[model samples]
Target: MLMMFWQLTIDANDPARLARFWGQVLGYQPAPPESDTTWWAHYRGRLGGRDAFDDRIFDPDGRKPPLWFQEVPESKAGKNRLHLDLYPTARDDSLPYDRRVEIVDAKVAELVELGANVRRRERGDSYYFVVMHDPEGNEFCVS
Candidate 1:
């Protein structure tokens, strides 16, 4: 038998706060027994008997994956060799590249208000993605 994946762990200077941010973004609800310094929250989902953190798991009509935040001391430094890529499920694949960029621009702005910062941008003839840092400077992408 193979072991199952239990969670996706994110390192944060402020685990509680970061967890809350991700919980909202992903629609996860706070797990029970929370205190002034709790580090875990559980989102409801199922994937082969394992819980998967999807997009929404809180609202009565929402559902998504499980996201867990852990505390860390130092701030993220240099570049993240690995990062998450988020794609809009409703995007039109036939849209022009420039138009897609425009759509992502609006999303980037919204994320900025939520404490994400644009780190870098790269474009190619066929594709492009932006590197962004979360409130604690962890890297992620929009493509």
Candidate 2:
């Protein structure tokens, strides 16, 4: 037997709204309809108040994993148990600290314009990163 990566699900107070924000951040698109149903038409019938509006985003090139946002009744209460670390180099971590910080600042500025709030900036002996919270208050890092 083999296991495969599918989707990463996030809890949100407004799933569709969060999905749009994340789609912009990740340069992803709405997941295509599995059959003949549009995404909204599919989830429309299932929306039952706060539990409604489940939405997913996909990499346009199909190279990255999909992300699903599921609506919940309660608001986010604290720090996330796990958070994403978005590197400006995308996966290259060998850049020098000054260069990395420069890239990080550029990306951070963009995200801030898109509604992300910078929680703080950190500088280590040999590294730099910025902590930011999504519009819904989910924390993630950029470096």
Candidate 3:
């Protein structure tokens, strides 16, 4: 695939709800409408009903690619062929193993409050991570 300026696209049953959850998790903001700064309102107005828009969110600091959530008819099935890994402590290599575990666990708790459910905790020879499912059951990891 062509790579420049690409955004990650997510399929969701309820695109707006999923987008809200991810926006909070990633500290992202919704893309504003061209004619209005009121976010969802303009989209809703244009569509004249619900299912207003395909949700888009961008990293506030402009470091990461934007996320675009599209409405899909089917539910998730089987394991994800690809997933996201979140580093709560910003992937610090100098940190102790136990310290990294603590940081990851703390971040997991925060995520749980935001609608993520932990599947399991995993420990490897050199790393620790938590497998989690989003509110809509998409799998991702915290480390």
When superposed on Cα atoms, how far off is each prediction in RMSD? Answer: 8.2, 5.2, 5.1
Better of 2 and 3 by lDDT: 3
Question: Candidate 1's error at 47, in angstroms?
Answer: 22
Candidate 3 lDDT: 0.80
lDDT of 1 by residue, 90-137 (tens): 356798988888877777787788788999988888677788888888
For each candidate in turn, the TM-score is 0.67, 0.79, 0.79
Residue-pair clashes per candidate: 9, 0, 0
**Which runs of model 2 end up more than 4 angstroms from their true locations?**
33-54, 91-94
Better of 1 and 2 by TM-score: 2
In Å, residue 6's CA in model 2 sits off its true spot by: 2.0
Ranking according to lDDT, highest score first: 3, 2, 1
Worst 10 residues of 1 by lDDT: 37-46
Model 2 C-alpha lDDT per residue in residues 47-123, reported as the tens digit of each score: 55444233877776665777889889999998899898898766566776677778889999999999899999999
Q: For residue 99, what is the lDDT in candidate 2?
A: 78
lDDT tens string, model 3, 33-95?
333334334334655553323477767655577688888899999898888899897899899
Best candidate (score: lDDT): 3
Comparing 1 and 3 on TM-score, the stronger one: 3
Best by TM-score: 3
